[model samples]
Target chain A: MKTLETTLRSLRESGRKALVPYVVAGATPDWTHHVEAAVLGGADAVEIGIPFSDPMMDGVVIQEAGLRALERGTTFESICQELESLETEIPLVAMTYYNIFLHYGLRRTAGRLHDVGVSGAIVPDLSLEESDEWRAASGDSDIATIFLVAPSTSRTRMRTVAGLSQGFLYASARMAVTGAASDQGEGERVVSELRRVSDIPTYVGIGVSTPAQAHTTAVFSDGVIVGSALVKIILQGASPTDVESFVRSFRTALD
Target chain B: MDEINAMGQPDHRGHFGGFGGRFVPEALMPACVELEEAFRDAWSDEEFVALYHRTLREFAGRPTPVTPLPRLSQRLGLRIFAKREDLAHTGSHKINNVIGQTLLTQRMGKTRVIAETGAGQHGVATATAAARLGLGCTVFMGEVDTKRQELNVFRMELLGATVVPVTSGSKTLKDAVNEAMREWVTCVADTHYCLGSVMGPHPFPWMVREFQRVIGAEAAWQLKELGVDVPDAVVACVGGGSNAAGVFAGFAETAAQLYGVEAAGGAAVTSGSPGVLHGMRSLILQDEFGQVEEAHSISAGLDYPGIGPEHAHLADTGRATYVAVGDDEVIGAMRLLSESEGIIPALETAHAVAWMVREAGGRLPTGSTVLLNLSGRGDKDVAQVRAMLMEES
Candidate 1:
């Protein structure tokens, strides 16, 4: 597996913006197929979210997907093993909280994910001050540690986060969780400001449901992230083909 | 002295016939060991004691009085005294523990303090400590609790503490605990987990009890000055058992009969068995597979699946007799105390008053003195109490 740094370097060299597709692992019975379809639909990297009982920052759509994933008993280890079996060549990122990571030891979890060809991780709840332990434990595991930036974040904190973030900056489109509709005006401002401070690539997330929002976001950042909308599509009992079609449409809009 | 010694060994680890051990995860084992060592060292350090006492006196308003319940005593035909912890700073005994723990948090070089609260009493206390110490504070409260105790949430916020509503699990105290523990595990380097009660793992129960022991310690001295060496009985409500353990710790060596009253939501003690709930092994209502069943009680504070480990040990050693009071009985006792004594007790404390009323009617002698730990004031519980009474009426 390529390191998160290497993945970013390659993306920058090719002048190709990275596309990160987030899907709750085991949200449906055939999640493996859905993940494969996401990659085929033009996703450069994939974010496999481990479902937790209380996803405080998730919106209704993502919450439902998380609930379905949890009911399916898709544990951290199980998700990692499933990702390991995937034939997709795209970099895989595991997005979860410190609880799941804490339940599974930091080093062990990071090491296992790296062994499974996972390229990076993003823990929304893990603050920068608290990242040192995880960083040390994930040492040379070749997995990137991605951090988030909210509009409410101060310049000083953003600099600190950018310095610590190994892969890219997940610029939250709004002050709220996933699924809330994004405001393009605010998104543009946050993206522009983050670009000034963040040395790494920035990806805008939260509420970029339609192809239009993704296209608008692509102007200011390396890429746009669509989480709640994809989960919503899967929860609506859409087939893997339907999800892939939607992703392709979104990718085309961005291009 | 004999009673106190019988309650536990001379070490602080033992409290009046109950055993306290450090049962924790391997990751937290080192922190617990360090805390135990620090606590021991601090206890012997005169400077530490002096600082603790000064803060207790000036900030926490220590040495809360024992008020004689004249009207309740007249109605019940027994001498009734209330250990008035309700008058303490923050209107509850919770502040006592928070003050001590916050000081320790500073001593440990932690920059932030995190706590989990059920009814928001502990959250308010923790916020108070954080404000006084100028430290960052985060309180995890169940979403339901935040809704129910919106005033306290505002109070915590006004005190400069961030109140994070936990929407997980049953969306109550237990889930708040889980969230706080999760935060602690990740932020242990710069945060102190200010446990609300004598629950959770090892040092928390022991440490909270020591801090709360002031309740019983002051009450014992006051009772002795009044020429009552040993009261006929001492009663306290048991939620996570902090108040009961604190009050009981003082008379552990005395001949005074100790009684812990639990919420009788289908008779918790009589119907439950020894099982692990939360992080400690205690008497809990559980299924055959050891899955903990939710406990039902009108009092949110007492609506816990398990009692504290020290309470379990006290029950096991027979140092304290355990009893459960039903919701109806507790409500009746609350009314009786409010009408007769004009002191509104918390629903948790009403459980103990109910037990005293029942025992005094059929068992106690006319001249026998009974002391009840009025663990908290009923201000926070008035709305709930009114709703419960209206439902019954």
Candidate 2:
């Protein structure tokens, strides 16, 4: 199996930008269907968010979806159980708060994700200083610990995170939380900053809401991640087929 | 263990034994690093120290006298002295920390401050500090708490602060913190997150406690001056444990046995396990699946599911004893303090009083000399208490 970093690197080497969509696990009874929808809609990877009670890094849309998922009895075990039936070959990444993994036992969580075909993890609240343990645990399972570099990250810190990151470095396009409505971001500058220090694949996210926004950010970075815009569709009762078209639109815009 | 003996300041990287560390998003790393550097520099400079002292003395009305609660002491047979933080400006120990943070904000060239509040005491204090420093202030409060603490909302507005009602999650103090953190990400360039407690990532837990250390320092001196060198026990209520940590800093190395009282429904030290929340790894009320559990208390200020990281370490190391008190007992204790000593302690502080009430003759022993940190006034809780009393009657 190709590693997450190699897969993204190969995709970028072939001049194809990566497309990833984020979906909250158990937000709906058929939330897994949405991940499959994004997979079939031409996404290179799918990011699954296990519901946590307090998501300090998330904005309104993701928070609402997480709460909805929690009300539906979502848990790490349930999310992994759901992922077992996903039936997708695309790379999968798990996005969540640090406590979810910390409480579940870091090594056990990493092994569990690997068992469920998850190739990477994105824990936003876990800083680089506190990530050595999780990084080692994930490495034991050959799971990539993807790291984020924000617009406000210092020059020295940017290089360290880029080097420590196992998968592609996530470039948060703005100094804002996920699902914020505005499209104004510092994607170009941040991506260039990462490019100057490391030769890894970088994806710009956080404010990439519209297809035009995705098209614009993809011009500078290796890929673009769409979260709140797609999650909004899922939260408002959009069917799997509807989500498929939504992901396809961004895929088309990027291509 | 040795560092903990010196009042538990986290190491250079902010690890308090095994509890506290910086766990925040990448967006805020630079700000945390910058703030840590700024704080280190300002804290050691004699000029900065002088300015901090002058502000506390003149603006916050510091050196709040230690009051002898004679009537209550006689009734309980435990000679008690109350460190009257209720007399401080803004009516709480919260003002001391805010004044220091707002001053530090100006020093860092930040022109605005943002904070999260549960019952509004911290919000009011933050607003007051910002007003004094001519800085813009915004406070995020849970929508549920805003309804429960309407007067506090109005009070913050009166202090010229914009109060945003957070509606996500359980819509309480936890959600308010989430909102404040989200807001800080966007505006970190010019705004300082004047955290209301000794919680959150890194510098915040250590920095907030350093600022709040005034409570212990003042009470220690006053006690010595009053010819009591060291009390038998020193106690305070714990929410995020700021005031408890503050008062404990003075007596941690002394002969005084340190005690922290927590609301039964919100007792992180008593009922919680180590888990990460609001950026710090601390004792938190969480489900088996690692999801944070909602905390319930009559006082919104104490209605939190987690305690400060240092408190968790202290509990783990057995440096202090922590116990829980119920809402019913807290209410009774509130009335007792008010009627007996003509002092209306905030329901948050009444947890300590309630714990003493239950243990005075048993665990605490009769005639034991005790120093209590009366962390806040109850004026803001008057309406809530009245409504609750009426509902009960």
List where candidate 2 sits over 4 angstroms from the true fold.
Answer: A180-184, B1-4
Q: Predict model 2's lDDT versus the native.
A: 0.91
lDDT on C-alpha atoms for all candidate structures? 0.78, 0.91
Candidate 1 residue B119 C-alpha distance from true site, Å: 0.6
The true-versus-predicted C-alpha distance at residue A185 of model 1, in Å, is 34
Q: What level of docking quality does candidate 2 show? A: high
Model 2 lDDT tens row, A1-255: 139988889889999999989999999999999999999899999999988999999988999999999998989999999899889988999999999999999999999999999999999999999998998899999899989999898889899999998778899988888884565578899889889999999998897899888888888889988999999999999999999999999999999
Reference contacts preserved by each model: 0.02, 0.99
If you superpose only chain B onto the true chain B, what TM-score does each candidate give?
Answer: 0.94, 0.98
Task: Please write out the lDDT profile of model 1 over residues A1-255, one tens digit for every residue.
Answer: 246777776786787766777889978878988889998898888888887655545666776787778667677777877877888787788887655675577788888988888888887756564467688877668778888876656676678778788878888776556774746635777778877886688888877888888887888788888788888878888788987887898889877
Q: Cα deviation in Å at residue B117, candidate 1?
A: 0.4
